[model samples]
Target: MSPPSATLPAIAVAGLAKTYGDVQAVAGIDFTVSQGSVTALLGGNGAGKTTTIAMLLGLLKPSAGSITVLGTDMLHDRHAVLPRLNFSSPYVDLPHRLTVRQNLRVFAQLYDVPGPKQRIAQLAQKLDFTTLLDRPAGALSAGQKTRVALAKALINRPELLLLDEPTASLDPDTADWVRGLLEDYRAERGATILLASHNMAEVERLCDQVLMMKQGRIVDRGTPTELIERYGRDNLEEVFLDIARGRGKAAQPAQAETAA
Candidate 1:
């Protein structure tokens, strides 16, 4: 892989907004994700986390603002950069009738991944899903499906990976194992990861930076330690509750630095 740009963020959003009729889904938020770092996007339901990610993926057009992904304008040039990134979400399911291997092969082809068969084999072995590769997707349990989804996300070795509730439906042991895979993937490939998860422990363990959202805007952002100290919390879960419930106001430091 080429050296990452010193100046450009892997993802840069300025004044990003999305609206549905009279309701604002995302209210002109601005943030940057550094290359080769793991960042978490935390928010309660209806906080616009999903909307923001959709806009980033060009699945939904922004009402107002700009999105530059990997130095390409996502609004006008999304196709050029789409292949460089991949996303995984439990909400998005693979074709039910397709076998696990078939699904992976299809995605690998879409991403133009070289050596698709070898790549699929490697992922199946690493994720410990080799036995399920030939099973129909609809026949797999939730945990098994989650692993398959993750494998599809990694099929192309994307430079930018966006994951939503990556460990949903996973057993504790398997979840930990998957997290290890993610850590290794980032270190070995120098990939940048943005994950949205309700599992605060998972966020704290995997993330280097945290972006907290409320009412469609970024309310605070910092290292996990910084937010914990600022919010006077023992863990990210506590800080999350403090922010989500309006127990604490956005800090001066975050407000000064962030465009909310």
Candidate 2:
């Protein structure tokens, strides 16, 4: 694929929706993630965060609407953009028998990364999983596996990175370290990161914008500070609680920021 126009948003979804039987997993939602920013998708369980991310990754076909990722149509031209993006989720497991290094090498090749071995080595060292590289993925502890998963997601140095609960299973110190690594990566590469996380503090710290979803629809969106102030709350967590509990002032449909 040719280079996308720099002015295009990293991700643009219009009237995006998905359903299963009688249940609508994601109601019509429209939003765009600006290029070179960290955007957080926040919601409680069954709120469509995962469903939306899956559609963005082209892992699940949307029942309606459209998704343009990195300026390429996801439904019809995903292959043209897939190489430019990667996703990580702790809930998804790697093959149990493959060693950490082996697993990363496989993903590296799939992304057509140059110097797969060197990229794997760089990631293992950067993620502090060098010692676990030879261990079977199933043999690693939860935190170890989380680090390895992150390494795999980053193997290709993708322009877009999607993460779900990125710091899950990590201790406080390690989680903070990982967050710093992500911040540095974005700073260096101007990468766009879209993450679904329950960790409010992490979102407040890393995200430039936040989209709050409830019942499959995006109910609110703004910078963390903007949301907090608008809700008259002390912090993002409080604002989140207000929205989740249906006590906060109702929000109008978001006009996604073109420059976050």
How many backbone clashes can be found in candidate 1?
A: 0
Report the poorest 10 consecutive residues by lDDT, candidate 2: 251-260
The C-alpha lDDT values of all candidates are 0.90, 0.89
TM-scores of all predicted structures: 0.95, 0.94
Candidate maximizing lDDT: 1
Count of clashes, each model: 0, 0
lDDT of 2 by residue, 175-216 (tens): 999999999999988999999999999999999999998899
**What is the Å distance of residue 198 in model 2 from its true position?**
0.4
Q: Candidate 2 at residue 199, lDDT?
A: 93
Root-mean-square deviation (CA) per prediction: 2.1, 2.7
